[model samples]
Target: MTTPAGSGSGFGSVSWWGLSPAVDLQAESPPVDPDLQADTEHGTPDLSVLLLGSTDGRHLLRTLARAALWPQRRFQFYVLENNLEAVARHMLIFSLALEDPEKMGLQEKSETFLEMWGNALLRPPVAAFVRAQADRLAHLVPEPDRLAEQLPWLNLGALKFRERDALEAVFRFWAGGEKGPEAFPMSRLWDSRLRHYLGSRYDARRGVSDWDLHMKLHDRGARVIHTREFRRWRDTGVAFELRDSSAYHVPNRTLASRSPPEPSWGAHCSARVLGGHRHGALCGLRHRSGRRKPPADQQRAASQATPLLSPETAGEITLHNVTEVFREITAWWRPRAAQGDPEQVRGDGDGSPEPAGPALESFTVHFLSLGSAQTLHHKSCYKGRFQLLYVACGMVHLLGPELGACVAPGGRLIVELAQYLVDLRQEQLQGFSTKVGELAQTAGFAPHPGAKPSETLARFYKAGDSGSGCMDLTVEPGTPPP
Candidate 1:
């Protein structure tokens, strides 16, 4: 069944296929003329189109030519490319007959040349030719502000066309003083503009121009309108490829390549989009208030508040310092195994401890538990050395040389014993007393000892054996150790 047109101006009746049967162009012509005339008088042309082409030149040219033939209205087309001079001459000659179609013989020749050029520009092998045409047309039109106001939309990079004059204004504002095709930073044009305004860059290195352009516009506060109606002519001699050619592909991969990679398990962990009553309520309130709640409020209403994690805030966590903590932990663990068995302490080929090997350089740090279990296991062996065992969540565990046999999940290092168990639960087992004595004695043997017998014993009990046994610590100050 044919869909009935929604309520709007007569423009609503115009579909991808042009005006519907109910709205005859001949019958509607007189009424539309007044509106068109009024728009023209206001210095806004009835319609102006900016055709951006590099590879799909023929397709766009033919599309514009056919569109120009619309019986009821005339559209002024501005083709932007790198070389404005050549395209200006070509278009002038091509449209000479149409400019005065009453002339004999010239009509067929003009039409034939238009078709020939269109076919050449649309073909895959003629991408260079298409690009040349685009280069020639880029500088032909003057008064961009007039075009911006006159044209309802402008096409850039790929998605056909967009109605965001602010974007074009930004481009024109930046590409100042520079002239000719040489001045245009075709590849990085979108990237630089997006980065300048939105603090984000487009990755056009992968031949993903269209998606990048859309994202760039979106990043810069542009609201894209998704229409069901087709906007451009399909199968107009241009071949559409869902995947781009390797030659046009951008090099840098991964979203992080757009900027620095986010640190592993930092404060800025990625989250899934959640929608429901709780989200709706908080977001609704925030939207109405036009301000975000304070951090204290977030902490107080942790269950309702979304995680306050972002790249900007994550930088404050000092991930670089975490590396030092990891190294300390590795040193502590290796000695413990060595003391248990000297043969096992022997260094591997890479100078790491046997079995566990050298210290881990990198590993995935899980913030939350798998399920009812709250175990955090480091999967891959770090730096081809030590295989990290499950450690307690929240608490920072340090490693040192004089360690002994202890539970896998939690065992406080002598150096940072006091700070480690400050926010943990006390254990009720004989193992705590024995382990603490051993740890304290070992600490005393070190060149610079920090742990006391009393402190070690207190921390031992506080440290849990299994990850689940560990207490859920809070990010607060002044908590007593154990």
Candidate 2:
């Protein structure tokens, strides 16, 4: 499906979400995420999207960076996050985009960005950059005027004052103290947690790390994640295999999340089925709610469907990060266009200010705090407002029956299925599907007719627009949803 790294890498729109066989959903008109390309079309409708808790920067690169830019197409993204850290990280990413291209290339920036995201520890420069942004944001988050003056794209008016204050504290924590080897000292804490989590198995951490990556992640079609990085993150609390820096000892506070407390987690989770091949891959995914195991018959069915990884698997998969996989998503927008002209293009390789191109425009992103409320009755007028409502895999468990109310009649709703979640945590595949379908039905939605779902994803659309919403190309008009 991939050609190679070409000259125009990071200049198109694409995604690794595997939304469908057609690929590059953003490359089409009415892109998944709005790109900042120069527009040739005269009249185009505005795009509004709502996202929950997928902090992958896909909006900026994967979704928005696709296709020809349109001047008339104004894009508004309503980003709903559970906590302050997500907003802070989003701001940090924005800061990276706005950095001077002369000093840091897009590829370098991508590398830095991903590491800062996945890794628990960071390189010296990465740490320094986070600290600098945090120091600035710490001050601005408290003062609305200053924040608007600086980071104009962000709209936090939807957030409560206390939420904003909490976010400021999150930024201050990232900023760290005046002088100390470690400000928050998360590394030690990580080690302690690791030790406790892996009491007897602690000595075999290397093997365990390798097992987790090769078995669980690789099996789930995450070939992009390399063994070395995964193992490193497991062993030393570091995800990215960057040039070693002494600063790696410092824990990345951004990686932390304030999750709703669960009861007696880590009970057991193992992916032991792939079709009929049982790999017996032991995944750390656990039953957090303290739920009981299903009946023997159900578990047997689940096991047959849930495949695990084989410890014997060798051959380290050379990691293909998001950019490598979604080459078009690699292209990024600068925070600020150079003083001379918005059309001026930064030299693809060389730092030469070139002739006029597409006028650089900014999109507004509203960051709102998502509460634990089961229904999304945020506003009375919020009904049928968004074209696309996406629920990230990590947030899928929070899916409510009335969630579809937020999506427009003809719009699409995508929920990333947490792999093997049904097999272990909930009921087997049938039950899981039925539960979700019931919810969607209650909310005036139906399984999207156009979509051909894999083991990984589920797509739906409001009942009004069933006109072949499927992106799958293999099946003509697509198979009927079972």
Candidate 3:
């Protein structure tokens, strides 16, 4: 098989202890179209395998290669090493073991070797287990009932997979449909409890390197096959740490030392090390599937409109916005109710307390712009039974009988328009354009002389008012009031 040129190389200058740099053999090259014609005349192998590794990875690679159905398949190896020294060591050992059968005692030394690097595989499985347990536990709890109760503290513990079937179910779910002794070797089997334990410590923010990549590939609809039948090597080596540490650690070292020597290999290796190619591939896949990035203009508009509120400002604004509307509506209701002359009410013989007066119980605040067709609606329910309607807008007309209240932009109205409509259900209010002279004659409402009425008004009545009515003034399609 012809290997890509820059397949394996160490990341520049940074000494990562012994970890290998990531390998990317196809960085600059476009993804191979699955439909592309193959050169069958050359008699290429049936399968193409890309083996990425370093010094420690030699044993794993040899085991895999030996177990693999080769000759019928083409195997392409890419070894990435941190330094020349490590690469040389891996090459010498691998070549000797492959060429001289008598010099290879890998099977005898397998247990001790694995013990040195076992955590590399064990940690990830443990984390997956923990997460599954947490999810199961959460599913068991009754959400609504818990929410309804006013509990100061609630502790829901871990889940228990009591049956072998339960464990098998999880394994199958993750491993997918292809399952058998050959497909999944017992060596790859991990303790089921590891899932639960590791899941508990899983941090999405920190991210899972291998799983994240796997998910990215899966999301792109890539066909991934898992062979569980491979020989299991016990891990006993130093744990690989990818965060806040040198990249020359366990896995990196292993990857670097085993990469192929080719220019394309280096480029591919660089891209993989930087995570650029994978990310780009995922994005490209998403784009090809009709998922697109927002247009620049839309993005700019969104960024411009995103309200930047400081913590203190946000809190104050929220509190004040709600409280101001509440207080204003309450003020409007208090006087309006007192106008009913409560003192004149005849008390019951044993008046313990007169049944509660109809005070402002709740209110719905609507913020609207007359010039712009944007409206923000907020509903606030009060303890009392009565309801108030608060309208904050640039300009509005409260269609009332003979008494129309016009509010300028940024003004508020607290009258219950719905109640007014109910009261005037039968009344037919005449439609009249707001004339400049007539508007000036109104006591509380005045219109700008230069401003023209876009449309004639249609009137209705207020609730509980026998003769009181209201008028709805709408703008014409072509004409907008100034």
Candidate 4:
């Protein structure tokens, strides 16, 4: 379950989205949509950014929303990801996100995005839409001409053949022709996982979820998600914020962070602080073959119980869902649609209203397989190419020469903290931070000396010359470099 480290048995973590909220690069925090007209009136070069391991396109979507997605200026996002599922999921998100207002509407797009983004199951419409895109996505991979014809802005040719094929196979499964969607009982699986995750306090799963929502999530001060919405998501693996859709029980096994995990995995992802348990790396993320099932009552407990939170903490946090959080983000679609000739909608060459137009030509995302990209980064062309390098949390070991080579001199490096784990303590977070800072230093980057100790966002400037230092950082589980 070490999802961030980018290691596994050809599988993704159970969670499709990062537990931590999405972040924007400080260098481009408030992205001014190049405003091509404003640009033509003035002038601006394309905004180039390289994003490493953007879990499931949330960061990218957040960035796009900030950019206002209009002609403002050309945008190039070189998205690097190792997980094929994330790639397949990314394609789906782009499809859903780009649907014109006439077809999906702002609320529909935001709701659908959140559904497909996190839940293992989906509403009927979403499921049907996913199935419809299977053939098109499958075909789009093998034909660069079709890729260009359909998603003119998206570039997937850089991916390896095997990676592309794997992506195709993933879409085929999503098609639901071979095996029925019944194969994945997401609610049952969600309950089973909750039981396992809660360990001895399986009966207190509701209480735990509440504690995590209020005592943990709210304890951080404020969050975009409300307790009710968070509880629903935690319980069902589905978010029903602006939710007009039906039961999200359709089993989006695609979000499963991994293929069916093997039973023999005894490794722990990282240190977790369970209340009664000592601070240490936690394991047992996989279910062994022929494992006994929990009693029916216990299995039904999480489902039968209503949402709960500590009495004293009820008013401690806001009880609002993220409707407004994403409502305005989705608002970007209306203007794009209303502006004259109705937004152009291409369905990966299928004539469906999937990807938005005009902006497509200027807004391109280079889908790079992490492993393949790592190899590609070694080439001379990769030297000093990007103004910013974003390293996802728990993936610090990957900031070796290959990654370091891509940053332009004086370019910035942003390292994320493992802020997802609600129960993780300050010392544990600091431990993660100090380890990352040290790794960044070794990788030829240094953070500003003025960065506060407790700050989660770490901005690092490329140290010394462009090609000054290169070192391999291999951090073992539970043992970060001292």
TM-score of each: 0.18, 0.67, 0.18, 0.70
Model 2 lDDT per residue over 1-482, tens place: 11111121111111112111222223221222223223336233456677776554544443444433333354567777655556778888767665566777656776677567655667777778788888898898888898888777778888888788778776775676534534445565456545544556668767766755566556655544446544555456554554654547655656543323422112111110011001111222111100122346654554576646321111111122233423332233432243345554455557755543323333667786666324455577556667767666555555665567677656666665546321233344456666666666666667876566565557777755443433444442222212
List lDDT for all candidates, in order.
0.24, 0.51, 0.24, 0.54
Q: Looking at model 3, how many pairs of residues clash? A: 74
- Minimum summed lDDT over a 10-residue window in model 2 is located at 271-280
Stretches of model 1 off by over 4 angstroms after superposition: 1-127, 131-185, 200-245, 249-482
- Could you tell which candidate, 3 or 4, scores higher by TM-score? 4
Candidate 4 Cα lDDT to native: 0.54
Model 4 regions more than 4 Å off: 1-15, 23-44, 68-72, 223-227, 241-246, 257-358, 449-455, 463-482
Instruction: Give lDDT for model 3.
Output: 0.24
Candidate 1 on 214-280: residue-level lDDT in tens? Answer: 3432232222211110011011111111123232322110011011242221222122011111111
Reference-based lDDT, residue 240, model 1? 17
| Predicted structure with the largest lDDT when compared to the true one | 4
Q: What is the C-alpha RMSD of each candidate to the true structure, in Å?
A: 34.4, 13.7, 34.1, 12.1
Locate the minimum summed-lDDT window of 10 residues in model 1: 13-22
Q: How close to the true structure is residue 72 of candidate 3, measured as C-alpha lDDT?
A: 21
